[model samples]
Target: MAEAQEDEKVGGFLGWIERTGNKLPDPVVIFFYLALVLIAISVVCALAGLTALHPTQVNADGNPLVVMSQSLLSGENIAKFWVEMTKTFSHFHPLGYVLVVMLGAGVAERSGLFGAAMRAALGNAPKVILTPMVALIAMIANHAADAAYVVMIPLAGIMFHAAGRHPIAGIAAAFAGVSGGFSANILPGQLDVLLFGITEIAVEGSQLDPSWTMNVAGNWWFIFVLTFIYLPVIWYVTDKIIEPRLAKTPFSNTASADESVQDPSAKLSSNEKKGLNRAGLALLLVVGVWLVMTFGPGTPLIDEPACPAAVEAEGQCAAVQRLAPFFKSLVGGFMVLFLGAGWAYGSAVGTVKNHRDLVSMMAEGMRDMGYYLVLAFAAAHFVALFNWSNLGLIFAIHGAAGIEASGLPLPIAMGLIVLLSATLNLFVGSASAKWALLAPVLVPMLMLLGVSPEGATAIYRVGDGATNIITPLMVYFPLVLVFARRWSKDFGLGSLTAMMIPYSVWMLVTGLLLVVLWVFLGLDLGPAAPIAYSLPGN
Candidate 1:
């Protein structure tokens, strides 16, 4: 712990940078360490020839390290590492995946659409149902993909204040549900699709069946089951546990004027009312169209035509393909839907003068992500280099090997992994990056040890998510610090840490126990994904 503190305190220049923004970590300095450490590791691995190692053993799509390893050691190979690093910045999902999503999200956030909607939705719920309701909403928001973080955190406080509860308790409760119950949700989410894609890629590496379909629904059953389990526990902990502890703690006074009580669904003037009605009508039309396409056999939007079954069964009773990339792209299209709806409302209501304002809203939305883009650039490179070093793979292989030797039950092993990931969270924050490094080794290792790739992925999810709120290393940790400063002027790093530690400890224990139970019960973690192994990859 002291060493961790010292590490945070290191480099005299960083201290100066910290003074500039009490809430945000100096990304420039963090990136410096990320680059330096990763580069050093890459160099060492190159010299030792350890760069060639990959945990999965199956090669094709190859590990993230593959290109970097081939390129980093010799001067001639430099291009390989640079190429992988560059792709992260060019993220190809139209307006850049992360950027575009954040764009729409930012507008909804900036315009107070998210905040207002959250308060109105939660505030109106019976006070007794508040905890469970928040937990359920958190689980549902998983499908919206990180919008909960952008929208729910502040919304929670607002709703709690409006309901006469401790606002921090509200924040903690919502954070607990969104993050703590991350692996458990009633709906398929970005995680379901992302992990399924990766697992498919991993399975392809073994070449038994390169085209096996793993849909977002693979983990559906398990997640749905866990959602119910999480609701009560989250409610109990929030109302009976966390809230009591934080009762004496003053709520942070960061409420904005825009957040003041106002009925979002209030009666509008003729023009405004017309605009909102038009927007609502358009949304209904869009939804109606989508529903028909999804339900209709042989509809282009409903099936993956290229897949043999999809084509052979075209117009047949079993041709649904909800997990297709085009279908999944709808993930961010919510922004477009909202934009159209909002634009219509604005036009009729006179909130929008013209198309320029619409464009401006989007532009303004994306502008806030400039800092995130910079951070992602350095982070992408650092991750690329770390993959090149092969250290993560080495650690994964060793960890898996140790677990295999113990002859532990699958649940016990998964429990251990959850613990390991939670411990690592104390220092690491990026879930995707951490999982990218972890998945290659652990996924296949578990496959070898009688755990399915889906199961392994589920365990990894549980492990990664359970520690997020408590970790000071989390980028948002310092923001929580700033929130604290509003309530307790003397707030510092230690103070925020002390405040969260109890919540963190109890969550880590309860969440991991939940994972163990899921494994024992043979539940489906999500659609098509089973919780245990039926056969080895070979």
Candidate 2:
């Protein structure tokens, strides 16, 4: 037994190096290093008189690097520096939005909603389809925020075990969908809308493309195509590659044991049966109401009422326009949706007894997220610091300038941006923050190269999505750590990294190819979305 324990420890350590030796630079150490370097650069640039209010040289290649000095820093611009810093720390819209919804989702999960619903939902699907279907379901559940992380990853083991398949494969498949397939989706999600809004903000900031706009479907057409591409790739990697490697191991878990041991004698009580009916009815009502609200005229579900008189008098476009906020408010919107759903389900299902119970459910939700929220706080602040330093902008500016100098055609340049995103994903993981930092530089740079904002944004999404499965900095990486432990007792961070590295490599290659193909085909990302440069200032 001692020998086995020692073996596990040695194996775990070796595995860690084997997997993460290439990527696990101590972020804490790196943070301080980058901060000092950036401060020095800022100080030197200031001393050298190279500080500009804005980086405004158009068509200039190889702009000389200037060290920033202290005197060049302004008290007025101090506010702007802090604001940019804050944007990094508080950059993730999906993080907050998902957490808010998870509060209610937590309550429902605590109340046995997921297990009950899953049993009912998958009662009849074939075993072969179970793994992929779980992946697909988790993909859909992203609309509910991070419920997939809370519910699906662990449940995959249980569900797969019941079907007499490898539970690890199940977990891998689901994890692949949730994180690996991060950016590709069949439907428009809150992240889609949020990223699009930021992309538009970035394009407008560049002044090279004021007319460029990114709608909700900016990446939809390409993502939808990639969904088919991803499913097969994920399934092949899991079933063919990952499963074979794990089959030699004996780290079986008990999570799936219960799923396979269902007793025929066990049955729902009369009250339980009635509760199920009520829950079903409530779910139907939710779907019905949402449809009505989304489609009905004068319903105010989507947009704010247009005050044409005010617009005409002020000579301002409707800046605070309708329904636009709903898309932006996805987190808050989902919080209410989950809270309402949990309450209704609890009451109808006789699980939630009163208002106290409802509050408890939300509290329970927040409680489950103690670790997650903390990580988010750290991630937010780190991101904020990166932004404040403006290093990301410098990198993007230099990169865009280099791409232009390469004299690459529009299609190749777009593809290169996607590749750049995948490479950048190695260190930075926040999509919005990275895009916010990158877009300001790349958006206008690409416009000058004759790529439209929507096209540039789409390429960015492909790189961002493809790298998610592999990056340790990805917020969900720790969760994937726990998932890996189910299959191998010695599994730790390195094990998870080893398991996912293949998927990341292949997906990065294939995803980039797909993005290039989209550009080649001259695809419309959405209604009024164009693939190439529109008439200047259109």
RMSD of each: 7.1, 6.4
lDDT of 1 by residue, 324-443 (tens): 543455545555656666666566655566877777877876776666566556545554554444454455555667777787777887888888887655555666545544565676
The true-structure Cα RMSD of candidate 2 reads: 6.4
Cα lDDT computed for each candidate against the true fold: 0.58, 0.61
lDDT of 2 at 167: 70
lDDT of 1: 0.58
Per-candidate clashes come to 13, 19
Off by over 4 Å in 2: 1-72, 79-119, 143-147, 193-218, 251-255, 258-295, 299-336, 363-401, 427-439, 447-458, 468-496, 526-538
- TM-score for candidate 2, please give it: 0.71
Model 2 gets an lDDT of 0.61
